[model samples]
Target: MNTQPSALANSAGPVSGDSAAAKSRVLQIDRSCRLPLMFLIACSLVWLVAGGFLSLISSIKLHAPGFLSQSSWLTYGRVYPAAMNALWYGFAFQGAMAVALWLMCRLGRAELMGGKGILLGAFFWNVAVKLGVLGILAGASTGHSMLEMPGYVSPLLFVSYCLMGVWALVTFHFRQERQLYVSQWYLVGALFCFPWIFTAAQLLLVFHPVRGTLQAVVSGWYGHALITLWAVPIGLAVLFYFIPKLFGRQLHSRHLAAFGFWTLAAFGGWGGMHAGAPVPRWISSVSIAGGMMMILPLIAVALNWHLTARGAKGPENNQVFRFVQFGAIAFFAASLLDIGGSFRVIGEVTDLTVFTTGVKALYLYGFFGMTIAGAIYYLAPKITGCDWPSDQLAKLHYLGSVVGILVLVLGLVAGGILQGVRINNPEIPFVEAIRSTIPFLGLSTLGGLLLLAANLAFLVNVIRLLALCCCTNCFASNRSPAGSGPAAAGANL
Candidate 1:
């Protein structure tokens, strides 16, 4: 059963019935979001492309070693962190913000307020990110893992965030709907979670540097907490909202969802501390325990969603479901890998190898990226007042993302395992261990190429759709009858 009504989009049908009134509200919400969401999503896609390009450059350097040796700005040291931060701040955070705001307005029955301010905040955030990435290329990075952006710009990022964050809370505060949904729970949590994680990370790592092993401890905590707090919650928010609604089913269980949410809140940040970390032994032990304990929430969520979407098949025709399904599955796999890898036995083997790359790819690209893609696919038509202009490109992006991430994760994991094995063996020379990983690195490079191509297609599709809307709006404005103004023309967006 297709849950989405497809005959016409944003068509002003007879406003005679309850359904019409309901749709009018939906369109109103979409319209309120049109410009801001479109701008944020466009920025995200551009950053996504930049992140992919830098990542590919870094991956190639793993094997080729001299792909861009002539350029100081493109050195692996700079490019790798630059790539990660681009995805982190530039693509993922902005995209998540866009999705979070849209979800709030739609699910909570809230009108978006402070639209222009939100847009300004987004613009400044991008400026800060641009300067930060450039600073990294210029050797001004703070040298912290997640807080690599220079200290000078951190205030701007935080201030810019507050501009948006305060408004997000305000929107939710004034929502018409009295009952809060599960998706809103995750979204609200993420809205608060990011600031806590970022501020603490920046204060300790950047403004006033922590000393010795504690800095590493703090860095490790920040990196892991980011995935758990910011990324995972937002990704789950999207999944929980979309899966049942798109599949035409009610959620499986409220109790289970509450279970998942609370358990994740309690345990999520505690994981990602490794056994060998120089922190107190008990800290590592607690972290390891917390990580294993996270499986409880993971199982809870998997059950809630799986049971809800049980009868529905993966629909090729529905790009939203396809991407959402891919993301949900990846979330499970990635979470499991993250939990399982925390065991001392596994951690000892995979530490400092390409296996970490596989895990990051699985979590970031496979889980969160795909979820955002699905949300964009679902929201673009409503917000733009038009469906995608090209199906072929959408399908191409889907195939490429699914195949590319899978290949990259598997190749890196297998390669990393072998690489780790060689590193752990005293008889094996470090040089030999490095050489053993080259073949797998080559495979990951190929995967990166495919991923890059897919994103290019996605970018083109977005641009083409937006162009069509713009042209339609412009054309309509020129030929409109008397009293039919911008709002009337906007209906054709």
Candidate 2:
């Protein structure tokens, strides 16, 4: 494999004159977005913790319905939507934004411009999410999956997102590097596509309100597009950026990447509607065809990444690489599952069941969450100028997350299949089908608890690191000026 020095590697290893200069430049760029990145990550952790608690309540309520039945606010309907909103908007989007912004700055070789605007944008984004989640709990939910946030909160989110998007575009415009990397393509695409999908969904589903079966079609399209175009693209950008860097090589094939990118762009938007929806036959068929066609791009991407990582396997021991690799495998696995589930025969059994939920968990937590975790592990130290406080914590987090997600997904799939079989049979009682899923639901709850513990460990580590950084700054500031002394010293780390 042909290789070149990665942006991150410019600051690693020996510190000769040229190397020192290169490292300094990289640190300077990193420092520019430090505040914004830290803010995003911190907010994401807060949301992760909150989401974990909500999820635990939700999971428990699945089998033990009386657990919180007395509290109207904690009812299954409200808690479920609250948990989903917290996880999706609070943790997922924030973490993804942090990763995307940081990667864009690093790849562009440009210090992030409009730092204040970006920070302000992040603040408003969190505010909007908070209001949206609260509204859902207050029974003001729009009742659309992934678009559950109430009507009023939509504009706040859209405006905040536009601010951040503007910063991204401006940063890219003023980049030092003229040539765009494959990761850049993915990042830019995600940045641009989100608002369009978000706005259209808001208008069709929430504001104007689509009529009858067309509502299902729009909902299906919005859900699928959001995952494929927004979440998956962000995750893929990280994979493309880090795989070669970790392996000390360039990507296996740029041509393959381009092909993958365009194919995904062309088909992913239309592919998600076939998931056992109540739409017309033509609509479902188009979705299935699009999904089947997406397999080619997924294969292209998987092969490129696999071949890149085939040789230098030493870094696979590192937590960042390990998480990324796990996520990459999960991505391919999830893709295959989606393709199979899109078929009419399989969709008939899996649609509107726990099986679909299992696939979503695999994609969101297994693939997107894992990849973002890897990116955070890799970038946090660089941005904060402090090494992670403990490798033990990192390892614990990785084990818990990976195992928890797998168990949760498997349990859901098993439960869904059992329920689907019973439900499909005319002689079977609905209550009996529900009863058959209790054990698996319990297992899923256990998995959620494990993940909660893992995230708490991560939160502790981050807090410790931040405290250390603050102490170091305070100590340095006592001896010299406030900004220059500690800031320069931290940046050099």
Candidate 3:
């Protein structure tokens, strides 16, 4: 009785009495959490657009240093980190929080009853991110890679995170359903583990100010954990839940899933050592080994997703599947690329270079961003019961994202490798080496522009949907919603 009214209605012609009841209960869960989740989504969208602009600025600055050189607050040192934090903390994390809460409620077969706390927490989280970004721009940063926010900001973030995160755990704990899905495992783990890691990093690196290179070690550990244990798990949870649910199939293998989960949990945190970290040899050795061992988990997860998606399910939500398929491929590819980077040769050359930027693009925008984009599309219709207003816009958004990321990643990866080679070669002057990469930087700027355009399209699409939900049909049609088929969902992208 995993009820999805629009998804189910799109695939199948009719629903039984049980499905009708299930849909009712599901709708209750959706409605219970609607305000907070939608508020989060809305807030996240703003940050996404704002981040895109900041990203565009940063990208332009790479190739053209004189564009906005007058403003100290807009310098690359400040703006780059600000853009990164905005997207990571503001857009990605908020979207994940909303999606995670919805999944917890759905899997638990319970309403998100106490939602005011979540809304309040989300509000505070936004305020924290805003103030934190301002701090970074105004030169009050703590100077850590991921933890750039001022020390004062971390506590508020932690408290707000706990507010939203605790409710998700409560929902999971009080689940009406006895059996927990694979997604639940990842979500629950991500929820608890991220806070633990974040808190530990704050204590050692920020509050206490660790001595010597140990500070770098802590920062590296926190950065890696942010993506690996926190962001990746949240992305995977959505994929694991949606792929099976959308395809109307059970997960391919429980054993494989268990193996994947444990492997990731065990080996994932053992990472964080840089190419030539000043830490002990054994530390880097352990990290490299852990990364190499991650191949097993990657294999398990990839196989499970592939096997689960092999079956037939009529004209599925084209938009949903398209995004998921791309995201799944990106996830696997990024994981492989990341593993490859663990080797000495690749690590040495690519360390602190734009090649690493390519990997991040693959991970952040390609995998997590796209998955969440699809989820937003799917969830929007379900939550608001409004058919998409425009297919062209949706397709445009997808195209821009896909093409932009490809161009951006390719430019950075190729440019980065070239830059690394020049840096390593004694004959090449350092300044000359930097100059040679300008062409590639221009290419990335183009890609950034495209991504910015794509996000703007998404914003418009969402606005249109809101208009439909609030006006026109005026929510009357929302109550007893009309069906949405492949044609209706269209190559909604």
- Candidate 3, 132-233: lDDT as tens digits: 999999999898888999999999999999998998888788777656778888999999998999999999988988899888888888888888898889
lDDT of 2 by residue, 1-493 (tens): 1134443332121111256666676777676667778888989988988998898899899999899899788999999889988998899988998888888778877777776777888899999999999999989988888889999999999998888788788878877666678888999999999999989988999889879878778878888988889888999999898788777665778889999999999988985566446777788889989878879889899988877667566474788888988888889988888888888888888777888888888888889989999999988888777789988899899999988888888888888888788889878888988898999999888888888888888888888877776677546564433223224423332
lDDT for 177 in candidate 2 is 65
Give candidate 1's TM-score.
0.93
lDDT of 1 by residue, 299-373 (tens): 999999888778776555789989998999999999988887888899898877889889989989999999999
Taken over the whole model, the C-alpha lDDT of each candidate is 0.84, 0.82, 0.82
What stretches of model 1 exceed 4 Å from their correct place? 1-18, 314-316, 478-493
* TM-score to native of every candidate shown: 0.93, 0.93, 0.91
Query: Stretches of candidate 2 above 4 Å error?
Result: 1-18, 478-493
TM-score of 3: 0.91
User: Candidate 2: lDDT of 174?
Assistant: 78
Candidates 1 and 2, the one with greater lDDT: 1
User: Which pairs clash in model 1?
Assistant: 384-493
Choose 1 or 3, whichever is better by lDDT. Answer: 1
